[model samples]
Target chain A: MREFDLLAHVYRSNVDLPADVAIPPGDDMGAIRLGGQTLLVTVDQLADGVHVDLATASLEQVARKAVTRNLSDVAAMAARPVGAVVAVSLPRDFGDTRATELFDSMRRTAAAFDCPLVGGDIAMWDHPLLISVTVFAEPGEVEPVLRSGAQPGDGIYVTGRLGGSNETLPDHYTHHLDFMPRITLARELAGDAATRPSSMIDLSDGLARDLKHLCDAGNLDADLTIADLPLSDGAHQAARRTNEPAWQHALGDGEDYELLFTAPRSPRIETADVPITRIGTMRPCAGATPAILLHLPDGATCKLADLPSLGWEHHA
Target chain B: MREFDLLAHVYRSNVDLPADVAIPPGDDMGAIRLGGQTLLVTVDQLADGVHVDLATASLEQVARKAVTRNLSDVAAMAARPVGAVVAVSLPRDFGDTRATELFDSMRRTAAAFDCPLVGGDIAMWDHPLLISVTVFAEPGEVEPVLRSGAQPGDGIYVTGRLGGSNETLPDHYTHHLDFMPRITLARELAGDAATRPSSMIDLSDGLARDLKHLCDAGNLDADLTIADLPLSDGAHQAARRTNEPAWQHALGDGEDYELLFTAPRSPRIETADVPITRIGTMRPCAGATPAILLHLPDGATCKLADLPSLGWEHHA
Candidate 1:
């Protein structure tokens, strides 16, 4: 039998609950009320070989990655993270010192981001170790910036540069390009009541694919100009080393964690601290046709829908 | 390498975060937003062969059990459950229909209890299926009913009967007994403002060991009467069939999900719908010793602390 089948058998019992539940269990994040505010919550599990390969990274790096990945979701909704709950299924060989270091690193990162680590569950698993982080954030009055809010004439923008996370790390622990810059930028932009994006989403699955998500959500088509893409130095270097087009890597590489948003054109918005570049505009959805139109630096344009879908598929 | 070591390696990169994070990830649950009406959030994961065996159980049962086990924690704290979020990791073999069934069961169960399923993360895993449910609750006006609230002269009370779960289900469904009586009597009793228990905790780890948690927390001793213990018909029958004392199972069997609380003897509050039995009285903590006293029917009292510690131990 499947694992879910087992869970269903042992856990699917009815319950008599009180009236305070706003959003119940089984969703991405269960929301409850604190006074008059609504809190959005969600938990994600990252397992070795399942979510990432541990052999290629450091313990502290992994811990930070886990926090960033979940925090990316909080950014997507334009919510300010309040706290988090972490549950770890450790292998028997795990020791206290290593656990402490892992926790300390995560704690520092969380504190740096304003969201505190609230509580967590630790266990010994005979199989692989699993790290599940549940984040709680306050949902603002603007109703989280959803992917479906883009309109036909909305302008599409991306914060920071993208691509090349798969390459080698930086020397002497200086700066890692993979670390998300959008967390601060998105919060800064969205928190300003004057500059809210019509639709906002984190680009974890690559801009090529994520832009499609934004366009598809509103049944709209997105047109992008390759010349406007912001390419990170590391990404450009990696593309050059591999003799590949930097634009393709910027468009197709996942784990960028940048914020991809759509909003009506506004000149009053400040773009100084945040490196936001307008890459495209939204149009009516072409139904059964390409959802994203990409203009090449050489004057040719291609439809993303016409290409083989890539990046990440949960099941694939 | 250990599982957690592997996780630490994969997720420990330095990432930028906000400033308010008091604790970061790595505890049983992370805690943040203290002082201004604290919120307690926790997530528990149930895996096939790990937490439950689902080969012989129904899907609905598995889903229900998954939700309640997490809900039981809220009951333990005497906190009102507000909402929950589910992160489901399913094997590819499990089709969308099966996933839908699991979610549907969860939705219906949450709705039945008044908590609506708001959002969640659904992913595919190569290993056994895993379901992580996170529960969110708010501590009411009264200070959070913590395990440390019991006083030396407080009366220790238990809600409902214990120990028949093992006998209530078919022999093949022994694990099913762990989650019976879906609705916790503790939540109901705590909700009634007039009779709220001073210190409330759910009996997930058997009455014998759990009461010790209360003793350790309150820095006091408990003199419990086994004769005053309430036993279900299934527990009695199971004892008779096994030629053992029924009280043993009642005190030692885990997964009871009943509320164990303490209160001052005044205010004379009674809840007719929920059965509550006074099983013990608290005493000042003895020097260098934290213990529980079991009063036998013969009026002889024995220190239960001398006996082997029973109930669930995650590592074990």
Candidate 2:
């Protein structure tokens, strides 16, 4: 069992808590109320060898990616980034200059997004460096766009193209360049009344897998058209060279950090600056065999239910 | 060089932050602003073997100690506790009941001090179980008590007896009793209107070492009277069995987590339930000499400056 399961078994026995906790434990982030404002708080940890190879990645890049990973969660909640606290466990070998570079990058990133690095902790450990960042955002009650909000008759839209993360893994993973532009664009669209989507989630864990989450949580099914998939040239070329299908790369690859949302059809919404493509439609659950029905470019229709979930799994 | 030193260099070179960060980059905690209120935020990480021995320490006690350590920091500032966030990195072998007990103990202690556990992160780590907690508190304007605030005429006062932590270490290290009450009492006493200590600190690094810190920071010297020292029976017994003086235990034993403050003599302040002992008075800085002067019962004065600083050092 996971540690959370153990925690639930031990502490969750007594369920008495104040009404301020809107979204309690066991979610991507916890939500609470403060003076009519809904606050979203989430934390993410990046270990040296497990999350990044520090020998290859610059401290600046490591710092930016650390904050961006949490920012992606803020985007998931459709919340404006407010502030963050970073706690770091450092190996004794790391010098002062490298540590400073990491903090500088974090401060710049937080400031660039108008979020402040409020507070944190620093300690020495024998283990590889662990950087954990907790981000807090003030998301006023405009209805938190959750995974369970997808509905039948809703059109699926994905912001930005996919599969490029692998071909340009260094740029996507190290520099954190790919996520910034996409997140900025997504946030702009989310803020605009004309382009606001009903339900939105950042596609960090690939299109096919994350779609299954949205569909499963909403108790609906998705019919995705493979022909309408938006694939990056780099991703397509890399997949071709590797003898892997470009569609599979676009469908199953993770860390894209792109927004995937479903909203009712609206013509006034412009997709000029934002490179969003219409991919599919939500439908009532059909058969027990397939919760997500994929309409291939070929005549074949594949069932996504029996497929294994993609992306990173902690235990696996 | 340490990772924190490197972090300081990077952050210093990269960007210009807001003006309110009084004690930024290095120190026990980072201080920031919240709508004109000075908020002190600090995080401390306790790993299984590094900070506590999980083999002997109960998970509940480990969790409580982890939070109490940070609470001691809030007490150091003479600030009231506001809230906290706890992030836990669990080894895969950790059971569910342990996680529950950990969270339950943490939540109870947080509530006991009126500082609720707002949110946190839980992840799986391969080696040791790491628990990091970040605490927040509002700084008092008149006396956001710091180590540097002591004056030459200031009299040093310590709340409660010292050296009892070693005797209670069995119960505390085993998770049989709560340490939050002692911490709360210290914080409450530090902020008491009647006392209004000029400079204050929490005694984690033993009385002699911590007094040296206060004296060094304030550019003054301190003389402690051995006769005025408060000794618990358990500490006295332990010292006697070890063939050592009981006063040494009261003076130099660490992990006391008591409040050590310096204030001018005040008629309004009288004795209360918590034991308050006038141990010493600050004097002019002796050039190239002792920062803390200990007056023993033998009538000979010994300099604490020559002694090695006590308590847990990350590198040591």
On lDDT, the leading prediction is 2
Model 1 compared with the native: what TM-score? 0.84
Best TM-score among the predictions, by candidate number: 1
Residue A212's lDDT within candidate 2 is 73
Please tell me the TM-score of chain B in candidate 2 relative to the true structure's chain B.
0.84
The candidates' DockQ values read 0.31, 0.36
lDDT of 1 by residue, B201-250 (tens): 67766788778777876788898888989986656876888776788778
lDDT of 2 by residue, A241-287 (tens): 77777877778777677778887764144545657788999998776
Model 1 residue A160 lDDT score: 73
lDDT of 1 at B276: 75
Model 1's CAPRI class? acceptable
Off by over 4 Å in 1: A1-34, A139-143, A170-178, A237-244, A266-274, A286-290, A311-316, B1-38, B139-144, B164-184, B191-194, B233-244, B266-271, B297-299, B309-316
The C-alpha TM-scores of every prediction are 0.84, 0.82
